[model samples]
Target: MLKTRVIPCLLLRGESLIKTIKFDKYGYIGDPINTVRIFNELEVDELVFLDITATRENRPPNLDILREIADECFMPLAYGGGVKSVEDVRNILSIGLEKVVINSHAITNPNFITEIADTFGSQSIIASIDIKKNFWGKYEVLGVSGTKKTKLNYVEWAQELERLGAGELLITSMDREGTWKGYDVDLVRKITDSVSLPVIANGGAGNLQHIEEVVKQGNASAVALGSMVVYQGQDLGVLVNFPDRQKLSNIFG
Candidate 1:
């Protein structure tokens, strides 16, 4: 991998792939297995699959579907959604996923992070933090797929997760998700500066410059691509693709 990781973060609705705008509206992308095959061919660094409906609908990790995905995925894979217990994390890793992203349960019971981290190891747990600007433009931490307000400051929460033994943080901007504007560098910077763990910046990214800005300015350790990798363009049709290898190497090298 390059010094900085550029990962495609795909969303899931049942077994089909979808892309969301601000965690509210969504558009169908394609089959999950088929999309993974394309990324494998592209030789991307990594892939992240988050089931958007899992937590909202009150379910567990769709192991059968995820099993298929893990079997087909050639690159290192991580998954989130409906992971509520240490067993959930255990089963997910048993099936071949590299890490588990915990959100709702992490808030309802902060000790869950420690439990999973202790049981499996901190490197197996990823704390998924969804952040959005309220009407007053104040950043609020969200849980349950960005539905419930946790009323916790993201930087403080990130530090807490780091203390609780989370290996990394997947910090996504709900306000910028699927907008193709760019990442919330200010918000991300605060979290990165506050925590020692690596952070994967998500939501908003139109092109290579956007990616460069987040890593260079925001101090992000990695980036997660949503629309930039799944769409042909802003309003264009769906296309399973990644950036050119040479361009990515040049940007980070």
Candidate 2:
């Protein structure tokens, strides 16, 4: 089996990096470039930078910022938010990003996934599914920064994305986002069982054991976290109070 990956998920509201709770209550964290530089020094395996407000605000991705990030980041980088076309994917890839994550665009035009995969290969594409549990206790797709709801069920959409040629699925629980309580394990398992592609579980990761639970119990191929690393402000140059990379690798091993 491939070794599970531990990734830091960064949210960009604009030039500033922010964190959100339950997909709401956005808090300014720091500059993206500074954070990326710190993570690079920490020898993180990968980084995901998402512009949380782009899609909600109906604006295109900030390529200039992305270019700046790409120039600084040594690890593989994945970018998403307000990406809607094959041209968008091409432009992002051209800027040295390893993967392009499509969320709202995939729902609006399902065929876009195949087009991207055909042009850039499936490995360059990541289908980001933002999910929220409704009052009835079923997970549903939340678009436009978790404000708009789509009728498509979470599992069904995930399976369809893989069939449409997404290389990976980034499953984030809006309900658990930034709560630090734990991951939505049941939700993670449901999505993982429904698709063969690697699933990166995001949202509500508070500690190292939470990471273990998500991987071993939730059955996720990888885990992503935010806030836990940035909240303490130990030092902008070093890793804060998150799991040690060597220990996490051992746990996954």
**What is the per-residue lDDT of model 1 for residues 174-252, given as tens digits with 9 covering 90 to 100?**
9999999999999889998999999999999999999999999999999999999999999999988898878988888
- After superposition, the stretches of candidate 2 with alpha carbons farther than 4 Å from their true spots are 233-242
User: What is the per-residue lDDT of model 2 for residues 68-174, given as tens digits with 9 covering 90 to 100?
Assistant: 99999999999999998888888999999999989988998999999999999999998999999889987889888888889998899999999999999999999
Error of 1 at 72 (Å): 0.6
lDDT of 1: 0.93
The prediction achieving the highest TM-score against the true structure is 1
The TM-score obtained by model 1 is: 0.99
Question: What TM-scores do the predictions have?
Answer: 0.99, 0.94
lDDT of 2: 0.88
lDDT minimum window of 10 residues, candidate 1: 244-253
